[model samples]
Target: MSAIASEVLISRLADWGVDTVFGIPGDGINGIMEGLRRNADRVKFVLVHHEEAAAFMATAYAKATGRIGVCLATSGPGGIHLANGLYDAKLDHAPVLAITGMQETSVLGTGYQQEVHLDRLYEDVSVYDQMVVNPAQLPALVDIAIRTAYARRGVAHLTVPNDIQVAEAGEQPYQLVAPAKPPATAPVYLPPPVRPRDSDVRVAADVLNAGGRTAILAGIGARGAGRLVEQLAVALDAPIIKTLSGKMVVGDDSPYTTGGIGLLGTGPSEELVEEIDTLVMLGTNFPYTKHLPEPGKVKVVQVEIEPTRAGLRLPTEVPLIGDVGATLEALLPLVTPRAERPLLERYQAKMRDWREKMAALENPERDPIAPQYLASLLDRLATDDAILTCDSGTIATWAARHWHIRGGREFYLSGNLATMAPALPYAIAVQHAYPDRQVIAYPGDGGFAMLMAEFHTAARYHLPIKVVINNNNSLGQILWEQMVLGYPEHGVRFGNPHPDYAAWARGCGGFGVHVTKAGDLETALREAFARPGPALVDVAVDPNEPPMPGKVKYEQAKHFAEAFLRGQPHKASIATTLFKDKIAQLKES
Candidate 1:
């Protein structure tokens, strides 16, 4: 007998270099599960507790390794559970493939048990969504789905009916058109990289050359163009401000780097944006419009691979549509180097003073552990080539400000989607992709609780990911937002009977430790990292510590004061403890 269609699908995936898949098994997908069992040596299947986690793992895998990540799920609820994570991949531009099982073709519209409109449900989040109605469509449909995902840099989805998956693939006329090759001799597909036009490059250089003070705002799209970006920054005597997703593009130690821009950014970066005569944006469509300099105030030149996103965020005088590295190379020779460096030096000095103030706040002598202290300690202890995944909320703020990215370290989060609870799943995926490298996760109490079951998934596979929980026992980011908006905090606090996450980790067959004091943080982190399997270090942090905006407006100050006067005096104490170092600067202003 010839190979089953499901087996052929798995073989095609293996041909494209997909060695691992993340998902849970069910009767609806039993055919695919059996195929996985038969192809166990070629492709490994990771059984996650929830389909959402599986989708997240796949998204992270693609983000970490520039390849198409794969995930599978059964019909009905299993397929529906993948929506959130699929949206994460969609918004963040991660290449991923999601395969969901369906009821038999005969029963698909008959209201069969566990039936779901998988194709319709996934349409919004997928770049290519299709349903396989016949066995003859097996390898071709699978191939197209994977290729579309890689080409579009988004999610590709396939809904395979249970009966079609189990049927023999060579029974139809279409199968005879192209004979099935042996599993070991399948073909592979690779998409070509896009390049920029010569005219666009020259136009960008002209815009930069005309400006008196130039600034470069880099994003994740400039990932591999570090050397080119650095060269451009040096030649122009421009200060570089990174978007949160582009934080790893320039190391914290680089003289030209002024740090992240936006709400979770530095004052120096905000100042640089305001002072610049021209803004050269690269590889990032940063969503925070208000945080950017007024569109009318500065001349904008944007470079992006996707032409549609070139000037979507800001009005541009020059939109260079091409690969970041290639465009920068072409634009470099046409531009003249600037001799004056006053603007760059001013921002660098401001950044130096800010770093000094942050260092003063990371005192180990403090009673309750400072979130910044924990993040700083983790940064010091992490390996030179470690991969860090941050969850949404206050944890993102702590990681953004304190987790200094060195040259080799990688840091990422839900950039456009800004979804919570991705830290653990992302860590698990990266650990699986690079078993020899270290993977660390920073998840807040609220985000961690959302997918806490994934801890068991890590232990079951012996992933050895280190999870650091910023246990503030509340929706800390939301609470601060309320104070800034002048709304009294309500329904934001978590009640008693707080979970002992460290103990939970132990129960899930991993090492666990809880640290309340700031002094014990480093030691606990060391012990957790030394463990052979998964580990969780839960650190109780101050719930009142706020993530300050880059520029505080007068209305924001008035609202903050109003919140404090309206039965929230704790905000005053928290502000004093957190902003004491900046008090001198405030007084001067």
Candidate 2:
């Protein structure tokens, strides 16, 4: 038996520490698939419907568990299926390998079935791309791909011709390469430090002396300074509000815990911030500049790692650049204690009010279930520590608003691009690496359809991921966009009758549950959550009533009115205007 033949390709993958690989099987990879079937002991192959979802699974896995995510595909159509997810991984800086199986070696010059040059096709999307013509080169090439993926800079591609995968090894000895360790940061700062504006110190004093209300806005950076954040809040006796990304840095149930702010903000967190005389912007570089209060109006002090992020939001009364934890620690010693603020009580009341109003959306009586209730119900049934991966469009809006991330749970998202169909693949990587933790795939019907084939992959490996598909039949989010844009809805509609997602799950030897009503929700969710293996929960939801991320202000309102009434394009050009600086950087780079 030739060691390099396609007959035992799984052994090489096993040697590379890969337990399962995500991809759909077809022409070019038939050899590899056969090899996997013959020696199922070592490595298993996951079969997704589209190579795109396969790639997305890799991206999620990398983010959730810090491992190199692997995906494969047949040539031409399969290879083309990977671009969207690959681009998402590139933008999020996730480590992923996209493998494409090419036609037989002899067929290279002739037009064969699905014959597209795989190497050049992925040039724009991948950081490193290669075509392996010799079996001897496979080991080293695979190693390179693994390392590049681990660095999280971009994706790596390996194109294997059908004939080459089955060819005899070149007799030369081969060795697998190990990846390098990450570089360490210096322990201490060198230059003599100018004493930072005791802004944190002043803010603490203001909150203590003013004896009224105060709010702490925690951003992603807050978690890195956990003890300091907790300490500052305790000292000031203040209520804390987190940004979406910073959801549970301070523990969602902390006595001081208020909900998120901006757009789809729930919990009178915005009201709380407005009422407070002193607002501490801790470790967050919130991009929505308009959300900031006027410099002269509020006693705004920002603690940040970057100066540009701090001053860009508003003229900071106190801009301290250092570890947020360390800064907060320094400030804690300087500030006096304070009394209870009525505004904190008021904010908590608002949080309750918002939750109550949103309760209707969660428990809708309409035929199709409300997407909000579907997600909220899932959250209640889910483990407090379960990981949630949200895909783009309406589902993202719903998830961002309703998904309650507890302190220990991780929320993985593609915030930069907000791509669709990422949840399934990400679920793969997350569940594969984290066998101890439960992972959930919260995807919209349209988004889930885009990567539904990944269901087979979930079945193959029996990875314990619960895919909650908000199967509303239409791309409701996009239809809303067209409705508001005043454009003729030429392509936004998607009312196709969906195949039985649950039956497909059962056919693949996984559990599947279809929830059509509010009463059906809890039982299905609990059943899926308790299932020992991979499962799919198909919840048919309402198509109308879009998610609310922002208030319908004059600009947004005008756009919708013009589009629906006069059929004219509205002014959402504010996004372009806001991102002008980023555009300039792109040009310079």
TM-score for each model: 0.95, 0.69
Per-residue lDDT over 1-589 for candidate 2, one digit per residue giving the tens place of the 0 to 100 score? 5455554345555665667677788888877676677667876676666777777777776665556677888888988887888888776666678888898878897998888898998888787899887665656666666666654356888888888766775422334385332233221213234234675566645544564556788886676566677666766666787877677577655556667777656536656655667778887877666665656666667777655567667666677775577677677777676555465566566666565555545544445566777878877777878898877778777876678766567777665567777877777777877888989998887777767777777787777889998886777677667755655344655655657888988888899988888777878888888988999999887665465543444665566555545442323432332244234334433
Query: Candidate 2: lDDT of 352?
Result: 62
List per-prediction Cα lDDT, in the order shown: 0.87, 0.70
- RMSD to the true structure for each prediction, in A, is 2.8, 10.0
* Model 2 C-alpha lDDT versus the unseen true structure: 0.70
Q: Per-residue alpha-carbon lDDT of model 1 for 1-589, expressed as tens digits?
A: 5678889889879988999999999888999998898789999999999999999999999999989999999999999999999999999999999999999888767888887899999889999999987777767777788888877889999999888889886445344666865333235565565667788778888889898888999999999898899899988888989999999998888889999988888888888888888899999999999888888889999988888897898999999888789888889999898877787788888988888766765667666677878888988999988899999998888888889888599997999999999999999999999999999999999999999999999999998899999998999898889888887788788979889999999999999999998878888999999998999999998777778876677898899888887877466667766675365345444
CA lDDT of 15 in candidate 2?
67
Return the top candidate by TM-score: 1
Candidate 2 lDDT trough over 10 residues, lowest sum: 181-190
Off by over 4 Å in 1: 173-187, 572-576, 579-589
User: With candidate 1 superimposed using the best TM-score fit, by how many Å does residue 304's alpha carbon deviate from the native?
Assistant: 0.7
Candidate 2: regions farther than 4 A off: 5-17, 25-43, 102-117, 130-144, 160-250, 255-263, 267-353, 359-361, 364-368, 460-464, 486-513, 533-535, 561-589
